[model samples]
Target: MKNFILFLFLFFLTNSCFPAIEKPDDYFYAINKKVSAVVDEPEEVKKIYTRELQKYKKYRTKKYLISSKYVELSLRKKDKHILVYELLKLNDDKYDYVSIACNYNLALQFEFSSPELALQFLNKAIQLDERSGEKYFLPHLYHQKGRWYYNKKNYKKALFYFNECLKNLNRKETLYVASMHNNFGLCFDKMNNTKLAIEKTRKAINILENKPSKTKEERLFLYFIKGNLGGYFFKLKDYSSAEKLLSQELNFYITENYSSEMINPSKQLFELYTITNDKEHLKKLIDFLKEGESRLKTTDRIEINKIFQKYYAGINNLENLKIYSARLSQLNDENTSKTTQELSETSDRLNNFIIKNINQQYAYQKRKNILLTSVIFLAIITFAFFILNIKTRNKRKHDSLERQKMILENNKKMLEKDIKLQNEKIKSLYHSLNLKIETEKAFLNSLKNIKKQNNFQTEEVLKDLLLKVNNLIQVDKRNYDLISECTLQNEYFVNRLSEKVPNLTNLELKLCMYFRLNLSSKKISSFENTTPNTIRVYKTKIKTKIGLDRETSLDTYLKTI
Candidate 1:
């Protein structure tokens, strides 16, 4: 907090983020990135937190740092993943002030995603303090609760919580104190107690302006007071004060790239400009107002339109007045609709209150009936349980015997089923082995006949086609990767061949694979992408490696393996 009262008043001083956001997305972006990192990569989360915190070590809010921001990001994204939940649970287990601070942060986060969860976290934080018998950041927790209620438009409850914050909070923590003061001012402003509101807002302005803000959050809070205080001045019809404060605030918001709060000051300034007949300011205001139609609230739209209407009326511009008048009528109808909506809301609130009271009474009566019925029911169940227990004791030995016999019978049946399954498995394996033997024989015989017919090209193609056998046999040679294709087709054969005949060349392997596939030397030449002489030389080198016996053929050796 820097002393802005003297500065704002003395200079009539100025100064104002998200594109349309009430808050700057950039204001939250860094926090979101860090928080997301914390959730997704907790082990690395420490280094990031440490680096950011170290930068602020000499700063006033070094201890607080941005630890709560992780939860804020998760809450904004409505991340329901167990990672963040577990992180919260882990922190909540500790009863220290830091942990309580963490809990309060989580409470703020959960207020958006899960209010009940937020309540639970707050209660736990409260419990931590209550058990410790000392206040530590509980004021901050209370202040946040005030904000939570304030957002929901429960000004009275919000005031109650803000009062709790002021009563319990330390005066030395100017950041929090200033925030509470600002919030208190806002609550009073909402209540329309102009004198009290003005007093509170001025107090807030002093605290914020005097103390240099320690954190981004503090700076943002200070910015908020600028607009809010401007709004209060506008309410008092102090146009000079409102214009000075609000204009500065708007410039600050623009510089900072923050949003929603800008709407408040922007509306106030436009009204001020129109009332003061400041054409230059009014024209400048139009640049923003056109783009801001969606950003301004209904109440704000109505107020702004009234200013425009007044401006048109003052100039006696008939066409412009007609346009403003028509828009004003439409806006007023909207207000009427909004007023009807508020009435419906009030009726709903009253009905809900009545229903809640009735439910409280009904719940008490039901609970009483249930307690009495439960005692009687328990007595009956106990009596029945006693009888059953005694009967069970007498039958215990006989039941044990029966159970053992039944177990033995089950064991016998299971044994027979196992035996049957084993026999079937053995038969299937035998059949498969026989079928494989016959298939190989037939394949070899067909190739031998092709060899007799000297149809080497046809035999080579047939061998290539046969490479598409079931995986249990061989892989299809579509890739023709000579190094691994043969090895993959029959690992045992490749391994044994390599073991017996070490250092066989790739060309030799290519020749051997064709031999294994029952292709003639001419077919092997064609498959190897080489001349027949090259195939002959490769086969000779392979034969020399294995020291192939003149009595046994290469195909027979490979097949045997």
Candidate 2:
């Protein structure tokens, strides 16, 4: 009985000392932490957002749920627009701003279904934020409203909301500040304030880069800013700077298979290449364009046509050049015609709205009895007409959606095709490179034999042959060629090493690069024109400076990087 009582006491004490494990669905405050993610299923989403979110209010999860899946419910061709409606039904005095965020999110998802619906939700978000007496989500609410106006091309109004976003963002809110600066940059770009746009984008980049930990979305924003910087540099006619930024972005996009975002960067690079007379890069640009021709929008095709126009002209191929020029002109003409047609349709709609409103007012005052009878009789006929009109509109929308889906599907296929072509080209280039190297070796061998056959008397002939061989076999000039190429190739390795060992000199940096390439002590010594013993001393110094122990494999560590 004593033992049992003691055991029960111990168990209770242990339970009191350590808190219970948090359930997966338990609510947790992310006060100082970044946002958490959303669940995938609708039932979970409803339980979390519709019920749990309202229960905890603004002090709970600031974003309610951070899922791109929830965002995607707003896009696409189908007509399921229930997310916002479901969220709006949760509005109450206690959790006003929480409900407000739901409304804004709903607006964002179905902004395409109706502009009025989006505006209605946006206004509700603002109103709820004002009434809640908490600035918890005011910045985010302002940002979303800015986006709405920005999408509508209302630059001034967008700036108003963006400025509001900035005011609420304290210095410690680096994420919000970075986002605000980024959107402000986009606004400035759209308004044609190129200088401000560049400044804002660079500010955003600086802010995000300073953060110790960045999410994938933050890194993507950095990539986008770099690409935007490239565009701005292109506008300023700084081709060299533009080429560097755009090329880095293009390389990332191609390697990561981000085909949707590749089009503009590719076009910008093409423009830079055309002007710089870089036929090698220009040929690559042409390949990318041709491979994506079916997927290109009017603007994309126009840009590509311009590139071909320059390429053929450079080669003095007049016939092909003329053909491309005609295509370019045709694309431009078609774009203009489409723009005019859209404008005409918009004007007709406005005129019809005005006339119908005036007739409704006049008929009510001028002939009340007759108008009433007519409205009653026409109501039945109008109901049937309304049903038919809805059917027709829905069918048209469905067809349009199908076309869009087909275009995207075709784009994916084209991207895959281009990737295959690129791989083949790389293989062919590798073969050509090997052939060139072999030919150079044979040529050098021949030179040696010829010199020997001539009794080796001609110093000038021997000197010329040696110089050509030195140019081909660049290891002797290791600092100039091998180290530079290695540095460019293993950027992450170089960057990490520099950060770890900031005091490293130029020679020490070279030692690190050699280590990164898994070069032996003897090979590194030979490259540095030194003895193996001297190379060992350098390696020890590097390992010590980088805080790695003797047993740690420096080369293996670099390989992981």
Candidate 3:
């Protein structure tokens, strides 16, 4: 009898172990049939059909949780038929508690999507979830409702919901609370309450830093907050502080290597450099801007131009100002057109998401009965499978981590190599410049010596030529006579003038003597022994050789020499 009982127990266990498996084709056909039936119905009926189809498809695909998200959208669409269908389907399922949970979620999605329907869905979801003892969904529900109100520009309602989300959030779910804080800060910033915005954003950053799961999105948000804070300081003209914060944010974006996040910091740097009149900073900023412009779409050109305009105006440089102004005008026109196009695209996406959500919700409602009956059975199998999967996943993750470490090591080596090369190139250029400068200095010294030798020869040649001229005109006789007399005389002057101007010769010497006496050219030419014509010719020759004007008195030139 004990052996018979054991056999019976084994049989029961084996039977329970095998889960009911539906074919993918059968599941899809049923969903398609339901969707077709809804096509000819009224808007409310059609929405119900779409939701049911999505729920069924989701459940059959083992994506019930994701599908139920559509039901919330249907609620947002305000189709009573779809909501009633969801509720009816929800009530019929005891095992498919997830479907019921999804009903509340769909209600939240509905309220989140439309402010006019928000309060109704918010109360309904709270009541339903409270009755079901599923309080975990309330925080997100409240947060979503608040976001809807926020979108409608109802700051008070939005703050209340956000506060509720925060109150309900636990340490394990702190990231959600941090996200809400960031949203709150953004709302405050939009309202122009910078102090409140700053406080809230700081709170978010503090929380995120303390959290174990710090995501890239959270870090990016922090950077944005830093940028905004920098902007606030910049508006107050506290340039030094503004620059520090903006630079920190810019560096953060660079470290992350996110091109999109780099744009605002780059623009801020451009403005800061302009205000400070720092040419080196401006050059860096311009290079960054040009790089961004090359990568980003044309739609971003207007923002680029706006930055350029401010940069130009801050410097008050005429050439840049004109170029930026023209660019601004062109980009403004282009941006207006692009804005219209983007608006249309956004509207289309909103419509598609709405339709998809409604369909998913309805299908989830339809699959409630089957999923409810099988959930516990599936849960047991899923738990066992998950345990085995976790071990395999962990091993794979370990390998992946090792590979990533190796890549990072290689990257470090490349960076070090680049730095070494740059240092070597700079040293080489410095040495080359020094060598070139030394060579130029030696060459200039040689040219200087040549110029000095030429000047000396020129002077001696001029002196000898004057002596020859004196001999040709017999002025040496006057000089010899003067030397023999030993008289402190006009005789020395007479001899000197004879040597300087000797063609006439005596008459010319008299003329030159008169000139040496500080007489004008006209007065000198009137002296005895000299014809005016001969005196004029002597003066012309001296003027030509010495590069002096004939009109200048010889006494002046002689005194200078």
Candidate with best TM-score: 2
Q: In angstroms, how far off is 333's CA in candidate 1?
A: 23
TM-scores for every candidate against the unseen true structure: 0.40, 0.43, 0.39
Model 1 C-alpha lDDT per residue in residues 276-391, reported as the tens digit of each score: 88888887786576566556667667666666666665665656656655665566556565424443343334333433344367775675566556655765666687789879
Q: Write the per-residue lDDT of candidate 2 for residues 1-561, one digit (tens) a residue.
A: 122222322222111111134432122222111122332244544444444345335444424433222333323236445644543443333345346556655665556567678788768777876775554456666766776788799998998998897897566756567767867877888898988988998898899888899865566556766887888888888898889888887777666665556667776887788778788988877887677676767876787787777777678676676677667766766776542444334333433343344436675355555554555556556567778988999999999999999999999899769545643443444344445566587777877788578465578666767766765555334334434443455465567767866677878887876676556788678657899999899888877666678899987775444
lDDT tens digits, residues 1-561, model 3? 122222322222112111124442233234334433453345754565466667656564333423333333333545653654555454444323343344444454454355466466556656664564544355666666676667788888888888887776554555566667876876787687867877887787788677676666556656666776677667667888789888888788767776555667677778777778889988777767766665665555667767776765565555675566566555555555542444334333433343344336676455544544455455566567778888999999999999999999999899769545643443443344445455556556655765777455666655655554544345334334433443333456566645664433554444444454454555444434456666667767665544456577555775332
Error of 2 at 167 (Å): 2.3
By TM-score rank, best first, the candidates go 2, 1, 3
Report the candidate with higher lDDT, 1 versus 3. 1
The window of 10 residues in a row where model 1 has the poorest summed lDDT is 9-18
lDDT of 3 at 333: 54
TM-score of 3: 0.39
- After TM-score superposition, the amount by which residue 428's alpha carbon in candidate 2 deviates from its true location, in angstroms, is 98
Name the candidate, 1 or 3, with the larger TM-score value.
1
